[model samples]
Target: MTSMPVESPPKRATLRQRVFRALSGEYFWLYLLLLPSILILIAVILIPMLFAFQMSLGNTSIVVVAGRGSINNQWVGLQNYLSLLQNPSFWQALRETLYFWVVSILIEITVGIGMAALMNQSFFGRRIFRVIVFIPWAIPTVVNAMLWGMIFDGNNFGALNDLLLQWHLIQSPIVWLNPSALFPQIPWLSNALSYLGSNLAMNSIIVGDEWKTLPIVAILVLAGMQTIPHEFYEAARVEGASAWRQFRQITLPLIAPVLTVVLILRTMQLMRAFTLIFTLEQFGLPVLSIQAYQQAFAFGSFGMGSAVSFLIGLIALIIAYFYIKRLYREEL
Candidate 1:
């Protein structure tokens, strides 16, 4: 029996058809609208990122000891990465950076959620209080760092020191900025913790960085909190639930999604906390971004700087990928 010839699957769309489909669909206009943005992003971000990766592989004249005047594009072939791996200072800096990032982000999330809850509640002058709390978030990181830097000005005349002294908290003006001046000679920016001590001098300065950044986390949480409905709280209240109970049952689950998104976003953001760290320079505290800057700019080691930058960007990309992945999963 002659079977009917099998119908071939419809011919696959050409590159042109694929392009047309992407450009003509509901979001196709959006794609068209966003084409420029994507192009710009590639041009401004991706290109530089790739170029930095290439630089990381080469020994730039800036960092290496070379003979005669010339751009030293020596193809070192992973020596830079090897040197980075072997360097004790790099490890120390990495340790310090990890500690700083983890601690600050944990505090920011906790405080951010608390602040968001407070803002979501009914209170007198809530608007004003929110404005005040949000002021820091609105301020530029450089400005916030500058402001805090002045407050901890390593002098008695600094705002915080002045206030503390005025309150009779101390008979003498303590140099807050000086590492060697802490009660037990706690190192501030001038030294690293010698051994694993529960309390380190670097902790004091990191608090400044935390203060400057926590408000940003809080603002993001507040935006999340606002999306939650009041009906859930009201429903819980109708059942004679305790405030804590209401929070646990009603607020927690409802804001969990927001919390997740905010956590990831803020995690990525805090990871790139370079500007604040740079401005609040205490040589003792070497966070990743600060280390990158010092390597590239101070030492003029472009290859090393490129390596540092490449690693940072790699981190940011991973976080972003996971963030978007979770978001997609939730949506589905």
Candidate 2:
């Protein structure tokens, strides 16, 4: 056979060229569609988050100086984290935050489930009742906190105290915000339990937060409840199943998905609860968000504050992970 010139395969594309081609290909429109959102997310979220992380690794002076429009980038590796670990205040804040979050969520879920159930049923003036229930959810959180704070004011003339006094519930007005007054002299309880005093300030804030947010959960659950078929309940009723049994077997399982979603969203929100507590109890209850704010603004310790913030985020992530896992398990 006659000799023929040999040919080499075309050169492989570089990573950049491949990426460019991919972006320029059939998905070009998709990439173009997403470009603005990506840029906005980078500008609004990722950049600030990374910058905050960088600041968390530095000294307080870095943030203080930077706030003044100057740069004094002094790197101090892990010292702030270490100090937070050693800080009693951080632990106390974490403990209180966990307690408050758990208790608040429990109460909110109970109230929300009840309200949602009632709203799901036929009743007189139900539309007006729903509007009233939803009004709190529409109110600004700060305003709700302020309203509750006034209601629970330490003064004898506070709304709740005045009501109680009028009802002959107490001889004198009880200072609901004062720990000492809330607990009095409970010898049986431990110091922490007694000192915390049903966490009056914290619980007051929790109640306010719950009041403002409960309607949201209820509405979501109601939406889910509406999706459930009437046939299932009718069949259960035909089988002579009691109301509680029907709720336990049918309503709960049918609504589990919605409850899970509501739980996760509420968990995340409650974990970072700040505005309500800040306006109502201030730092009287040492929750992590409150501590973070106190550290950043009150004490001007930005590094520590950033550490506290990252820690809170970490806790929220962990909690979300478990809840998400539960969701997955249920779906499976």
Candidate 3:
């Protein structure tokens, strides 16, 4: 009897065959789907970023002249960065930017978390209240800044001073816009604290910015709160857990991730804060963005401005990397 002929095993797919299969499969569809976004990002973000890096490496004058499109610039590698590092104004601006970022984000998180907790409760008109809280956020940044400027007007026309005077809060209308009176003295503190009163102008801007952006943090936190299962709270309650205990044990840990996200986002936003501060009080208080603007446009030192901008960008990247690492560690 003739035995059944043995069948040969199927050959392994060649590299070209695998590539052909992938091109005809789900991966190809995904690549097609992502093509438009990738192209747009290259055109809008990547190309400009590369060009800006090139500009930062050279002394590109930003001055606009009729019939002249651009100024001739000489390549001077790292000179702009070195100059910015040694510049007193750059240091001052960097300090002020960090101060604003830290102070504003702290206030925002504190107030935002409080508001989120309050809003999460079942209350009449809660929806309406949420909308009201977001009104400043809904308004354009320019309008928000302008509105605050009007309210903080140092003269009789100022609404804040008007209310304060009506309530007998201040002896006289305070000069809110005066750079000389920007920071108030902390009489109890010594040395640098006393000198740090010069930050009142920046502080005022910080307050305005916090008002506009606090709702964003609150909303994010509220979303986080929603993700927490009610059963967890119910179980804790059944276990005789106090409200504070429940929050500390259950709520805080769950919400910490969202808070980290809020912190990173707020830090980035405040680091590059421009429109509000520029509109409300231009050059009165210097932050990094304002400094970059002054260097690039005011003095036509595009290279130095670009260097400062890139430095701030570097800081943002570092912070983002740190938090992302923390996020991964927490997951582990």
Candidate 4:
């Protein structure tokens, strides 16, 4: 028998050859397609966030010197954060922001689910009704704020005041935007729960925000509802399940993931609510976002503003994390 020649080991791929192979691979096109978006995100979001964080750690106030202005970004090392923690106004703003977020989110979720359930049903002109429901959300935030402002105007000619006057609900026109305790008659209760005191201003803001935002929640919930199989409802009906029971047992559990997403999104949006509140009340109500705006623009305290913004972002992240964790726990 003839001895077979030993096979030579294949040469290792050079670094350049490996790189070339990767560049020519199936995923190369996908990475190339994503490059522009990644670059844009880095330019628009990541860079600004880094700059803001740096600013938060230092004083970035502009100082004028001999007809020339220069940014005084002297490192203060968490002084801005420390000062915000020590400030009573900061705490008050945080409380107001949380109050607004909680109240508005509760109302939105409840009303939105109801509206979604209604729209999910088959009825005459259901499409038209859905369109009408969505119209408020389609309206721009600034426009919505201005429209509500007119309705809630303190003047006698305001829409609400006029209606109330016609109905003989009050003897005089009410200043709807006034920041007064909701229950001044119950001083103890008012003192105990100052944050929830039904201030007309805050309530009006909530109403406007809800009117514009509720439709979004409804739409989202409706989308979630659509994903539920009609067979589920059919099976429930076969078991003689009532409408409420069907909803509670089948609809809710199935759509929980969607609701969790909605909660996270709405919480972030409500926490950063500035345009609607600012347009409606300006600096009248001190919410966290407005406080940040005032610190940056009104008071020229960019460092403080950045710190507040960073805090808001951190809070949003924490809330989102909790929501996601709970969702996973429920799934398990």
Candidate 5:
């Protein structure tokens, strides 16, 4: 043993020293790389958000006179929020927003998953089918909105209604944009038939939105499905499992993380669905975002408007926080 002296083991750094080294060592480059994005994020998101929260505490009478500046205001306290609580339109908008997300996303998730699963199978013209599905997702949101507005135009300008009429699907061009058609029969919850009709009318804009965005969901799900190993399916088949059975067991479990990611992304996307809804509201489809904009700009209830915007921001912030937490938890 004396003829072969062994080297001593390296000592472990203390936690505080390790942390100090992390702050000052090669890993400092990670922070350096993150700095620009952090600054940009602060400038674009965090600072603006702080300003909005401060302004939410103030009203136009106090803040507008001084310009949209600073983190101080006349401090309307909780008046804006209290007003929103009592405001019927705000409440209605919020209710509609919730309904839109719940129903539309239900359809989107179900349809998107089924479509992606189908597209993932070894079928003929798979590439063409994928391209077809992806085309709508590729369209600009503004353009998609505009196109839907045109399609749902209450006047004789709608291609969809024209086609329906041409195909003898209906006797006349259905005025889809009519407020009556869009929000008919307020006592819908009283009866199943009325409720179904109300749901159809209420979901007109959602239909257009689904058409525009379902392709994206499909693409995302397909990407997830593609990441699953072929061996897993092969093994399942070797054990005498059918395709559906194998998907139920192996494919679905493996793709759950991706499904969660896609869902979270779509949730955040639709929560602040402003531009499209705004354009659609031009056709009288009133979603929360559009209603908020209308209150702030069109109706000039400056306090109400700010409050509505704050509410929208609050919801989005909560969803994003939860989603990020879920992502981190899943990672762990």
Candidate 6:
């Protein structure tokens, strides 16, 4: 009985056993908890997107025959997309969309930053004013559209017209929603303002949209401002920096990230502004979203509609990617 019993090596774990071990690990429960949300995202967003992309690649349409409705889809490669590129209406809509997006974003960002800076200051009823400022944003989009629509109703009964008349601003009620009514002459200016879309109609939409969305930008900027330490301002003040200099140097740089976020979100939202435009002017101002809707429902051209929709999404992604990449680059 000289030697101890020979020791045996541990057996390797089987694949099933390894997998089971992983599933039983600490992070497994976290992944398990996220499963439902992942599944929902796939079902709701990914699946529909895939289907829409497929439809965009084909000549898809709806046909009604003998009291029956059916889909007519045919593989057409990039024909729908190509045709859309060649379409004048598509380009016009794109121009109008870009114009609206640029103008509205500029106004919103400017006014929003100003409002945020004001609100961030210590003042009487500041909290109450903040609440009141957010009320427009909280109002339902449909209701806001209706309210603005009534105000710009192109009739004497319209609130804006009524007010203007009361103030002796105009001798007669103006057709505020009429695209052609405001700037019919002025050869050079007409072309330039055509980007404004239907003159007052587009401008009216911008105003309405600004009223609802400026609050969002202001609130976000205000949050960003709050994150900044008061000591920064104090230090700047010690150096004899004026208010404008303090904002330009200290406030803006610190809040650049928040502004980036606001830009991305507002750009995407503006691109897909359908309900407000539709309610205010119906098919009169054919922005991208309305174009897609008209192509699909009005003309029964599902393929073209899907293409336009996909294009809008693609543009949004591109813009987001640009902003995010620039942000990361600046950070690094």
Q: Model 3: per-residue lDDT, tens digit, 1-332?
A: 99999999999999999988887887999878888999999999999898888888898974468866776567999999998889987877877777787788779777898899999999999999999998878989999999889988998769999999999999899877665543235444533542443355666777788889999899999999999999999999999999999988898789889988988888788889999988977876778998889988898888878888999999887888887788878768
- Model 5 misses residue 39 by how many Å? 0.9
lDDT tens digits, residues 1-332, model 2? 99898898999999999999989999999999999999999999999888778778888653345347653546898988899999877777887788777887898678888889999999999999999989988898777877887898877889999999999998887666653423436655646663343555666667677878989989999998999999999999999999999999998888988998898888788778898777766777668888888887898778778888999899988988898798788778
lDDT of each: 0.71, 0.82, 0.83, 0.90, 0.74, 0.90
- Residue-wise C-alpha lDDT for candidate 5, range 34-120, written one tens digit per residue: 989999999999997777666566674333444564322467888878887887766666766777777777987789999998898
Clashing residue pairs found in predicted model 3: 182-200, 183-197, 183-200
Which numbered prediction scores highest in TM-score against the true structure? 4
Query: How far does residue 272 in candidate 5 sit from its true spot (Å)?
Result: 1.1
- Cα deviation at 332, candidate 5, in Å, is 9.5
Model 3 ranges off by over 4 Å: 1-24, 62-68, 180-191, 194-198
The pairs that clash in candidate 5 are none
Off by over 4 Å in 4: 1-24, 63-70, 196-198
Error of 1 at 309 (Å): 1.7
Compared to the true structure, candidate 3 yields what TM-score?
Answer: 0.88
RMSD, one per candidate, in order: 4.6, 4.7, 4.3, 4.2, 5.5, 5.1
- How big is the RMSD of model 3? 4.3
TM-score of each: 0.80, 0.87, 0.88, 0.90, 0.80, 0.89
Candidate 2 clash pair list: none
Decide which is better by TM-score, 3 or 5.
Answer: 3
Kindly list the per-residue Cα lDDT of model 6 for residues 1-332, writing each as its tens digit: 69988879989999999888878888699879999999999999999999889899999977799999987789999999999999988988988888888899889778999999999999999999999999999999999999998988778899999999999999999877776635558777887778555366788888888999999899999999999999999999999999999999999888989989999999899999998999888999899999999999998889999999999988888988998888887778
Candidate 2 regions with alpha-carbon error over 4 angstroms:
1-27, 62-68, 181-184, 188-198
lDDT at position 300, candidate 2: 73
Model 4 TM-score is 0.90
